[model samples]
Structure formats: structure tokens, C-alpha cells
Target: MLEFVVCFTVVAILGGLLLQRLWHYRAEAERAAVQMVIANIRSALEIKVAQANLPDGSLDFTFLTEENPLNLLKVKPVNYAGEWYRPSGADIGAGNWCFDRADKTLLYLLNNVNSFEDSQTKLLKFKVKLTRLPHSPAKPSGAPETLGVAFEQVKD
Candidate 1:
């Protein structure tokens, strides 16, 4: 009887530890998925900038900031919930992407909130901003300055 009880307790403890490890892994996977989406968005933004630069020697970055960055992508992620103005938590839900038009920020509501560290609100917010590279000495004086796009994390 004593041996049976000890074996049961060991099995129970092991089961609990296994469950905790699984949750940690699930949170890590969620973080990776979010990063992948952000990377795709960044690539799309770069393509848009290049396309714009081809047409004009001077690029106006003001419009880019106000525009929805997701629109630049040829195909958005399946999890994307689309754009919203002043979206509430219930409206956005977890494991979804939403663009908050009110502040021109993209929001990702995390489903695995246990280990997500980007925000305390269990949401990750990002903003697209224009980036300018320093003038290169090798470039000709008349050459247009290099411009790029940056995906910056925003605190909510």
C-alpha cells in the first residue's frame, strides 16, 4: 500500500510538471508566429517603398505613416481580424490581428498570455515609421537620399 501511494504521487507530480512545460512551449510558439507575421509585414513595407521610389526622385513619407501597413501585403495572414477604430478587447479577441485606425497602430491579441512579455495588456502593438539612412560619402551629391521603413513596438 505504501509503495502504491508513493508511485501515484510521483506520477501526479510528473504530470503537473509536463503540463507546465507544455504551456511554456505554447507561449513560445505564439511569440514566434507573431514575429513571422511582423517580418512579412516589414518585407511588404520595403517593397512598397521601393515601388514608390522608382516613380519619383523624392519620396513623401507622411502618407505611409497614416496608411494601414497591412494593405501593402499581397495577402494578409488568415488570423488577421481586419481594421477597427478604437477596438475593445472583446471586439479584437485573442489570437488575432487588428489595425487600430484611431492611432494608426497594428495590434495582436495574444492567446498565450502566460509568457508574452511585449505588453502587460496581453496585446502587442506595432507602428510603421519612416527611416532615413545617413548620407553616404560615396554617393553623388544629386542622388536621392536612401529611405526605409521600420516596424516599431508601441506600448499601450
Candidate 2:
């Protein structure tokens, strides 16, 4: 009886530990996937900006900020749920990507909330906007300031 009890307790402890580790790994994987999507969107934005600049040099960026960032991508991510004006959690559900046109923000609903750090919100919000790079001292004083688009995280 004593040996059986000890074995049972050991198994329970091991199982709990394994479950905890799995959750940790799952959270890390989720974060990595979100990062990869953000990187791809940023790359697409850079390409769009470059293409616009090729024409003349003066390119209007106001339109880009209002446009859906995913539209710039050749192929949208499979998990993207599409655009919504003002979506609730129930509207989009968990483990999906949604763009809120009203707020001009891209949101990622997290599937695993256990290991995620944000206690206030289960979703991650990001935005694409025009950003100006600092003028390089190496360049001449008369040189034009460099402008680019940035994919930035927004707290909501």
C-alpha cells in the first residue's frame, strides 16, 4: 500500500510538471507566430513604400495609414478572420487575426491565455503608421529626411 501511494504521488507530480512545461512552450510558440506575421507585414510595407518612391520621390503616405496592412501582403495569413468595424471577443472568437477599421488596428486574439503576460487584455493590438528616420550626420545638411512606415504595437 505504501509503495502504491508513493508511485501514485510521483506520477501525479510528474504529470503536473509536464503540463506546466507544455503550456510554457505553447505560449512561446504563439508569441513567435505573432512576431513572424508582424515581420512579414512590415516587409510588405517596406516594399510598398519603395515601389511608391520609385515613381518620383514624393509619395503620399496618408493613404497607407488608412489602408488595411494585410491588403499589402501578396497572400494574407491563413488565420486572418478579415476586417471588422468594431468587433467583440464573441464576434471574432479566440486564436484569430482581426482588423478593426474603426480603430485602425490589427488585433490577434490569443488562444492560450495561461502563460500570456497581458492580464488586462487577451488580444494583441498593432498599427501601421508613417515614421520618420532620424537624419544621418553622414549625409549632407541639405539631404531630404528619410520617411518610412512602421508596424508598432498599440496598447488597448
Candidate 3:
């Protein structure tokens, strides 16, 4: 009886440990996925800005969300895997990132949906900043514009 009880306890403890490890791995995977989505969106935006030839050689805030300005950028809409990524604050069902063009900076929010409970392991909230640095535009030679991109995880 003693042997049987001890064996059962050991197995239970091992199972619990395995479950905890798996949960940690799952959270890390979610964070990586969110970061990759944000990176792709940023790349697309940079390409769009370079092709647009803005009068001031900087990204116009309106191009981030407004359809009219977006069309003029000549960059394909953000697409990943087999789905199309829509604008932020739109139906988030098919998208993982949201775009916010506030004042002078552009913001990309990764994993914008907060579906996890307070007690549950939550995905990281990545806030990517896109700032247009001040520089003189190259005269008519079509040099690509320079923009600064930075990212930080927001703690809730």
C-alpha cells in the first residue's frame, strides 16, 4: 500500500510540473507571434512611405488609417499567412495589430485584444513607435526617406 501511494504522488507531481512548463512555453510563443505580426506591418509602412514621395519626405499621419491616403502610398495592404490585415479599430476579427496615428507619431499595438483574465497568463502588449526624423529631402533624386522605428512592451 505504501509503495502504491508513493508512486501515485510522484506521478501527480511530475504531471503538474509538465503542465506548468507547457503553459510557460505557450505564453512565449504567443509573444513571438505578436512581435512578428508587428514587424511585418512596420516593414509594409516603411515601403509605402518611401514610395509615396511625401512633400516633406515624412509619413503623413493620415496614411496610416485613412483609405484615401493609404491608396496613394502604393503599397499593398498588410497581409499575413492567408488573411488580410485590416485597419486598427476596425473589425479585429482578422487582424492582430492596430494602427494609431496620434499627433506626430505613429503607433502600432500588437495583440490589441485583451481576452485574458487577470489571473490568466496574458500576452504582451507591444507598442511600436514610428517617428519621422527631421532631415532635408533629397532633391528629385528619389532617395528613400528616413523614419525611426522603436518598440516596447506595455505593462498593464
Candidate 4:
């Protein structure tokens, strides 16, 4: 009986360790997905700015009208940080989505859009806000902290 008890304890320890490893891997994968989203959005935003007939954060046009310039590109997630082999709701939408070009200084930075409509499908809506760097329209800061997991496996 003593020997069996010892063996069970060992197995429990091993299971715990394995669970920890899996969690670490999952967290890393999540981080990568966030980064990919940031990169893609940044690139699209740059293009919009270049073709923008108004200003950098000008929302006064058709595709990016000053009133509703939130429908820029059909934000879609083709990848999920080289992880999650399945289609993660952590992706973008299937239609054009605009960027909030309205003084992304304090509010924008604080409330950036990390992902698109897809993130909301899995109830992970508003993962993070992707904001443009201040005084540096040519540059952007893709902070990792901003891109965090919003949902977790809920317990019954």
C-alpha cells in the first residue's frame, strides 16, 4: 500500500508539471497571435495614410470619412502566430474595417483595437486596441502587454 501511494504521488507531480508546460506553450502561442494582428493592422494603416487625401488621422473621406472612418480594410486573420492549427476567433473579420484616426494620442493608446470582429465570435471581443504612436506617424509601438488573452476556459 505504501509503495502504491508513493507511485500515485509521483504521477500527480508529473501531471502537474506537464500541465504547467502546456500552459506556458499556450500563452506563448497567444502572444504570437497578438503580434501578427498588430503587424497586419499596422501595415494596412500605413497604406491608408499614404493614400489618404486628407491628413494622417483624418477621418473625413469616403473609405475613411471623418464621421465613420472605421471601415478601412476587410480585416481578416490568415494566420494565428504560427500556432493554433485551427481557425481561432482571435482573427479579423471578412470585410473592410477602418482604423480610428481620431487623435490616437491618449485615448487611442489606452483603448487600442488588438483584433477585429472575429475575436468577438468566441466572445473575446476587444482583445486590444491598436493605436498609432504619438508624433511618429511613420513608426508604431507594438507593445505585447496590450495584447493579452481576454477569455479563459470558464469553470462550471
Which should have the higher TM-score, number 1 or number 2?
2
Off by over 4 Å in 2: 56-58, 114-119, 136-145
lDDT of each: 0.85, 0.85, 0.47, 0.37
Number of colliding residue pairs in each model: 0, 0, 0, 17
TM-score, cand. 2 vs. native: 0.85
Error of model 4, residue 80, in angstroms: 13
- Between 2 and 3, whose lDDT is larger? 2
Question: Local error of candidate 2 at 63, Å?
Answer: 2.1
Could you tell me how far off, in angstroms, the CA of residue 111 lies in candidate 1 after the best superposition?
2.2
Candidate 2, residues 1-156, lDDT tens digits: the string is: 999999999999999999999989988988788878899998988888888789675577778889888898888888899999999987777888999999899988889875357646788888988899888879898777788889898975
**Per-prediction CA RMSD (Å):** 2.4, 2.4, 8.4, 13.5
- lDDT ranking, high to low: 1, 2, 3, 4
Model 4 ranges with Cα > 4 A deviation: 53-75, 78-156
Q: Which consecutive 10 residues in model 3 have the weakest lDDT in total?
A: 103-112
The TM-scores, one per candidate, come to: 0.84, 0.85, 0.49, 0.40
> Tens digit of lDDT per residue, candidate 1, span 25-128?
99898888888888988888777777778866447767879988888888888888889998987888899999999999999888977656746778889999
